[model samples]
Target chain A: MEIEIERNLVMPGDVVPCPTGSMPGYGTYQNEVGEIVSNVMGYPAMYNRLVCVNSLRGCYIGETGNVVIGRISQVGNKRWKVDIGASQEAALQLSSIDLPTGEHRIRSEEDQLHMREYFNHNDLLSAEVQSKSQEGKAINLQTRSSKFGKLKNGMLVVVSPNLVARMRQHFCQLNNEVDIIFGRNGWIWVYYNNTNELEVPLIRRQQIVRISCLLKLMNKALVMISPEKIQQVFERTSDIELEDLLAESTLERIKDIDAVE
Target chain B: MTEEILFYGFRQDGRRPGELRQIKIKLGVVDNSSGSALFQIGHTSVLAFIHGPKQTKHEKESGHIHCYFNTAYFSSSGERRKFSKGDKKSNEFEANVRTMFESVVLMENNPHSDIDIHVLVLADDGSVECAAINAITLSLIHAGVPLKDFLVSCSSGFYSGMPLIDLTYSESTSFQVISEYRVAVLGKSLQIAYLNYDDIGGHKLTPEVVREITAMAIEGCKQVHFIMKQELQNACSN
Candidate 1:
């Protein structure tokens, strides 16, 4: 018997169980009987557990609390307006800038933050969505952390915004080293081939296969270039040098592909 | 690659005088876009996405059909550069695309609507515009946009006194043995979208060279149309 998720059970970065009993969540793996919660759909609500489930969610959209990559469209009074793959522009206030506390005290429109000093038009940036409004058109953003800031000197690749959510759910764990931003409006900003930042958690390889499976399903709904293609593209075009491990992995994939044929 | 031989009766990439690069096309990759397709010939990879058939955003005329063709060219380093908003290159491309598409698209079906085509070149080894047209046609078909016929394009250059099928970046940028043509063929009739020549100043290409290149491009155009047809059949059936 197969079980289907009536709702979204997990976000991208979440860890689930493996049925083989060797991986995380295997201890609590439920096979025969399960309880469904109101907000949730399936069983084994633990830090790490295995349960058969289905995900029936609407089309992925960008939202606050999500880290996104955007292009600075304009600079204005103490704030920067960015096109975060959203229908409406998101505002990044000067106050949201994470400057050292001891270095600066007083804040003024021109004195605290000069528009050109931070980001210029057409500059790609990595930021976090801070908030949204009643109309749902307006968005606030922040770049206070070291990880969040202008993405200078990098190649920015944008894909269909709808794929952003799916990509983001499995972010930072791709076999290929890269940084990605899942914009709400189905736009994905990928900084190709960033080896320094791509720390493949043990969980990532597991999720990658899952992503591949979902992508296969999506391929039926619409004609698509698979995630593997995108990953290959990043590896091919990335500015970073291919480490030995990465090169070996690529060779393995190439061999596997050839072997299948 | 060295030692250009004139009247050699052989072209680079092992083609007999006049031949075209192999073409592979897949339509409707991006769902949100009404129409989309990926075109590949050799190492050149281009993706074209078509949106619209909606009401015209530009207020030219109430029922006049509008077609916008925007192209993104990616360099060898993988850096992408777009044409200016209303620059000369864009104006020329837009005019050619408008004219070429208007000829085939049944604009009268939806007089007041618009069709916007965005061609994104993931890798531009050479013949960017020609590949773009092939991809766009498939995308439009996938989007179910009504059309009178397929508008196809291909590039040819005079190299070693022999017409090359599709010039690679090195060959295109080198301007060696150079009389290039951007020929658009629709069934029996042919239209020249843009033509450029280098090195041979004030001298017209020989009639033989022109004929050979035109025939090669038209043949390639037919292949492109075939691919577009199959892609449409697949998309519709699915």
Candidate 2:
């Protein structure tokens, strides 16, 4: 089926054109006269019978089943509060994580006493959103699988969540010997595998910085991010010096490249 | 005084009875704020910043809005004077602006959250309340907060048996003017959100005069709404 795409720039209080039986989504409201009006300054996108406006800039709105990286802000009796850069801190319950010993036993008071040993305040971890509260004020997070756990020996880069595209595989090991974790919440982790060896090559460190600079540039330009685009930009900028990648001329060049696509 | 206040059908600024001052709005002027905007109406200027939609610490309500109105010591007429935090006039203005916004913004959508609006007057030529309202509206738009409609405000006064629209500070405070009123309305629905008389004790306004002044104020608000809508669209397109 061929779907027709209609995009229009709209501002607050502007009456949007909606056909009968069409439903208004986010950034839109129906007035008393039954006309759909925009409630934000953004681009209105139409999909079949549904219309929604995508704002130019906004805070991250979390969703269920999305992998996110967060810092532990508070350790409570049975739950830990994680700051994922959302409107509200997410709750990570003691019952949601698996012990390091790989035991499936029930959580006890003794386990609560040892919660600090597993995770301390300000410790970073990756987990999936399990559920949201009835009022949508709080999110429940779970990290039962091995892939979701505490992060160690990594540098985190924060960007707008809108830049990060949701994908199946957010974790990748680049050919340059650096591992990257692209958190759906727009926090990226770059680190070397210290478990295998303590010393990382100087070339690997340069590549990591290059990738980070590229990501920052793309975010500044508000380009939709994807793994392919990152790899392509990295390949195209290989001729530029590492320190010069963030210069005004280089950023302008990157923006031009993004515009072309 | 009457002849000087109204010259041939024009106000002191050479504007017609219904003409408004030039309005300029720029969004995202303050990079550190979640959202900020600088709004200028003729010589009057105000900068507004919005921070939040985050977790509320004390209030258990679904959504809470806090507003602060401040004027620089040099913003007023004549010599500079130190301002106290407990100044009654500033506090009253803050409370009024906060209540007006709380009515238009869709607070129920953001439960357990608070939105703070801080407005600073950079210049005060006339109609500071109206300028502050416009600045806050643009700032909220930059923040991407959901709203029912754009709340636009304007000031008008009855002078020389005619209603003058978008009055300047001089025109509003002139002894020849009978009454001056500030009005705010929601653009989409044209619903009145706020209305107040700057000075009502000196003269008793007839029903017909009150009705005419209100109609003129609403007209001025509509004009402001058009300019604000255009500016918001310009911000999004580029």
| Interface Cα RMSD, each model | 18.2, 1.5
Estimate, for each residue in A199-233, the C-alpha lDDT of model 2 and write its tens digit: 66787777677778888877766666667777777
* Cα TM-score of candidate 2: 0.87
The alpha-carbon RMSD values of the candidates against the true structure, listed in the order shown, are: 17.4, 3.4
lDDT (C-alpha, whole model) for all candidates: 0.54, 0.82
Among incorrect, acceptable, medium and high, the docking class of model 1 is incorrect
In candidate 2, list every pair of residues with a backbone clash. B126-B169
lDDT of 2: 0.82
Q: Model 1, residue A62: displacement in angstroms?
A: 32
**For model 2, how does the per-residue alpha-carbon lDDT over B186-220 read when each residue is reduced to its tens digit?**
99777899988867338788899889999999999
Looking at model 2 chain A, report the run of 10 residues with the lowest lDDT sum.
A1-10
The TM-score of predicted model 1 comes to 0.44
State which candidate has the highest DockQ. Answer: 2
**Model 2, stretches more than 4 Å misplaced?**
A1-6, A45-51, A173-178, A196-214, A231-251, A259-261, B1-9, B58-61, B178-180, B200-203
Q: What root-mean-square deviation over C-alphas does model 2 reach?
A: 3.4
